[model samples]
Target: MLSPYKVVTIGDAMITMNPISTGPLRFVTHFERKVGGAELNFAIGCARLGLQSRWISLLGKDEFGRVIYNFTRGEGVDMTHVQFVEGYPTSLNFKEIQEDGSGKTFYYRYQSPISTFTTEMMKDEMLEGVALLHLTGVFLAIDPKNVELVQELIQIAKQKNIPISFDPNIRLKLWSIEEARKVYEMIFPDIDILLTGLDEFRLITGKDSEAELENFAAVYNIRDLVIKDGANGSKLYREGMWTRVSSFKVTPVDTVGAGDGFDAGYVYGWLHSYEPDKLLRFANGVGALVTTVSGDNEGLPYFEEVDAFINNELIIER
Candidate 1:
């Protein structure tokens, strides 16, 4: 197997099926299945950009579960630790895409086989060659036991001197705000780069303005903070300086996984030693490209594609 280029991400890997519909209440028309999870999307996004990435998760022994494993393997993800359980169905998420191709998703993931993950499922040897480890808030929402497992995993990485990247990929439907805030506070100190959005930051920190956000970042011992605002561009707060980067314009095909694409781009830049301005621009470019496609991982670009758009040799069509 090839060595990791920079980062390894850990979380649930699900088979996402989005059914075509004219509206939210409409019945399913047809469905398209894709592999998605915040961390998996981040890993795939990194791999597509020529970064050697790995994803650690669990899947059932069912056909759908095998499909997810095989798919990620084909994406060049190192799958040495993807556990397969007996007699459990893979966690699945269903989406209803409106005529405009924007809609909500409903997950059928409670009590999933993957939800049983503990530190035992993850091996110390598996993390040996990785330069960084990426995690998200979803792993925290699974269960208190799983939360403790994730925390232990991060602590291990920290002790091993591997960089830890965190994204508060906050989903209100998964847990209450108070519960989420309590957990966020517990995990913030262990994070190296905190990738979050305006809504999540405000909800977690109870802060409203940029100044308040900045002050919170300082107090939490966060090394870097990137706030993603869809279409409005992104803000980067690092080393006591703040820079705002404008987003690339695109006609969005779907908004799902756009933030994951953003995280992937930012991580790629971080691994490659790009300057702050360049990193933010490249991340926005990746995010804008993801919006033009129907699936989160489908629209992610290779280096050549991103370079073409960045260099203005090709126009980004809506």
Candidate 2:
């Protein structure tokens, strides 16, 4: 089957590490490495779901950067827009998982090559073929230059009538609440599709009613609004219709990146002309599937996997 649309995503990518041992740090002696970045993961998810995805980033020339670059390339995401810069070290992050499945993450991305990105790096000619532009809040806070670039990209996407998908993957540790709010307000008016976690939405908007959700969408003229509430599933609002889709049952390893995976699934539906219910079901399934494995994108389902899951066909291991 052909993809619903072609996409181009922009943001930072980094090496993610999680302790192999479950208990205290003193006893945890080893760690497993994985590559994760909000936009990067979204690109992988889209590609896995049978879409043409291109991920653009400024990575360091270090081994860590090479690891992400090679892995992303191997995953079938277009890497022509990715540039590995010399003299800058790739970023690293560590995830300390608690016994109860909670995780604490520490980031070391300051001064990374991606933080030096500027608008001159964007490839405008490529936008002609792209069906959508994907972005996250992470890049806006990474650097002032990136903030300018985000605005420029949004404007360009609007001019070309290309849909813009945004996820406010809020990382409070990276920037202050005030800073995040400022950027959100500036871009809120331009977002065509808004994917936000229920918690994050409440945290930012301070309102929990469906009316509040619709009010924001109506005022902003957002065509698609998805509110993801983990475990309980997600709800989508569009064109005066509201649909709630249930989450699939799965034993979650690490819940990080599920939202990004879900975004990919929902965007796939939008690309392929799926009805709202099917879109949410597919998105919820994709989100839950990603949580079955430890790393971010490791559990991202391929087309066959998604098909099997949605069709109620289970694969039993021998």
Candidate 3:
């Protein structure tokens, strides 16, 4: 059964082709196909945790698009708002992983189908039962018009009194730091929950101190300021109070979608009204679990799995 809480997010999904062997892409002959995207991963993560997750986006009317659509739908994400369009091609990315599980992606999405999605296509009815509206920098970075679309969506979300969560998820490969900073600043004031990395926060605010982060949150009137520090832990600031949680230790197979899982777990805790400490710990656990498996949303755990993992009851088979 689905949880009463619902999460809605808008972004582009892509067909990711990961190299079968470690090292340079040039030397790899075979690849494995997978579906991946920031918002899509978050939606799948939420769905895995039993939330009614709705995704909004456009995909190319092609084989790859069908694969992505089927995979995401099978994960229990609501597909009512997703559409396939002709002419444009679905986006694709090829990943090159090093021996240590770290990797870089090469994108081939110049003619993205999501570029056709406009603000006019967004309807207020789509957000009717949404408990949270999530956004990310990846969508905004895809196209300049997406900035306006997100702004319009934010206005509608605000009108409907839905809380907004945003993850910068900054990708320098998509845009310059200057460009990202400008766009992020424009969206920051409207974000109620800010989920970002410590490095990203420093980069975005150009401030290195916790005091400055507090002042920035105060300036924006952000209710929840969550910082996700991989491996080290995560910290949360709400109502002028701070809650910190240490990360669970895990050997990562791939670190690609860990942050998205963390976002989903955080949202799940938020909807269930978990205390700050428990929320951060749960989120950190989800993130660590994601790194224990490969693929995009493949490692996103159900509520039961997360519970077991957090309690140190989960056993892995080699």
Candidate 4:
């Protein structure tokens, strides 16, 4: 159990099976099992980048839970806050890749142990020394009970002056857009750092232009508003200044955890007091690097790997 972690992330921990063939369940011959949770992915990426990241979640007392526990622990993240409950199973997700390299996922996570989280399971000591509290929209959409837990933690973190890094990884599988927008509006003002997908942000705010987005951030009193433009790049609006950074070039194997990688990289840079350019470049570099592998956080590079990648390394494949 690692102590004095820099960040604390809360969300579901689940397994994903990506089918090799694109067809019905009968025709899809092969499937690969891997961890698939946005907050867990962020925690792993932060750990790889040399941060003592603590991930808090509820997992089932089963083999799937063991896989997540062992894998996350192996990544150097502190899972001491993870609560394992009985009678419920862990969540499972199935991924199907389309012909155009797009992905379609089917989640079988109803009544999962992770979704049964409550404030009692998450003790006060978990937020004692953490500088940042990381959250996502998934937690809000998972279950009604999670609302009390999330809002309580948010209030506690605010009282302790701990900033929150929020990623609205919108998922329609668990909830609808209208529901997401309404909950987000209520949760928006408490968030300090907003790392949002541009499309998702647009969908929620109806702000198509960057200027309009900036205004939206200002209205919410968001300290750091980061707009993720996928391959095009990332834009950061903070301290009354705007900065844009380009993404690194890489042939992607899977695009699952790139955004989480970016969140981790940006957090790492911020913790290390990096300049704006360095922060965005490092973030984009990490985001690009994660796409070279299949699993969510498998390709998340180490400290030296990030340096090498950002500095133009030799001609070789990852």
**Per-prediction TM-score:** 0.94, 0.95, 0.97, 0.95
Per-residue alpha-carbon lDDT of candidate 4 for residues 1-318, written as tens digits (9 for 90 to 100): 232448999989789887868765556889888887999999999988888899988899999999989989988888888978898899999887766767677888888997667676656788888888999998788886776788988988988899998998898878889988988998899998899988888888888687897788889999889988878989889888999998888888878899999999998888777888888999998988888887877888887888888999823285
Give the Å error, residue 289, model 2.
0.9
Better of 3 and 4 by lDDT: 3
Q: Is candidate 1 or candidate 3 better by lDDT?
A: 3
Weakest 10 consecutive residues, lDDT, candidate 3? Answer: 309-318
Top-lDDT structure, candidate number: 3
Candidate 1 global TM-score: 0.94
Per-residue lDDT of model 3, residues 181-249, tens digit only = 999999999999999999998887788578988999999999999999999999998999889999998
189 Cα displacement, candidate 4 (Å): 0.7
> Worst lDDT window (10 residues) for model 4?
1-10
Q: For each candidate in the order shown, give its overall lDDT on alpha carbons.
A: 0.82, 0.86, 0.93, 0.85
- The top-ranked prediction according to TM-score is 3
Q: Model 1: per-residue lDDT, tens digit, 1-318?
A: 233466788788789986654566456667778888888888888888888887888888899899988988998877877889887788888877567655677888877877778676667876787788998998788676777888878877987899888898887888888888889899888888888889878888888587887787788778788999988999888988998998887888777788998898898888777888899999999888888887868888887788788778768665
Runs in model 2 deviating more than 4 A are 1-4, 23-28, 315-318
| Preferred candidate (TM-score higher): 1 or 3 | 3
**Candidate 2 residue lDDT tens string, 1-318:** 557578988899889887996766557789999999889999999999989998878899989988999999999998888898988889888877778866678888878998767777665765668899988998887776777888888888888999998999888888887888888888989999999988888877887789998999999999999999889998999998899988777777768789899999988988888899998988988887788776778888887787787778954231
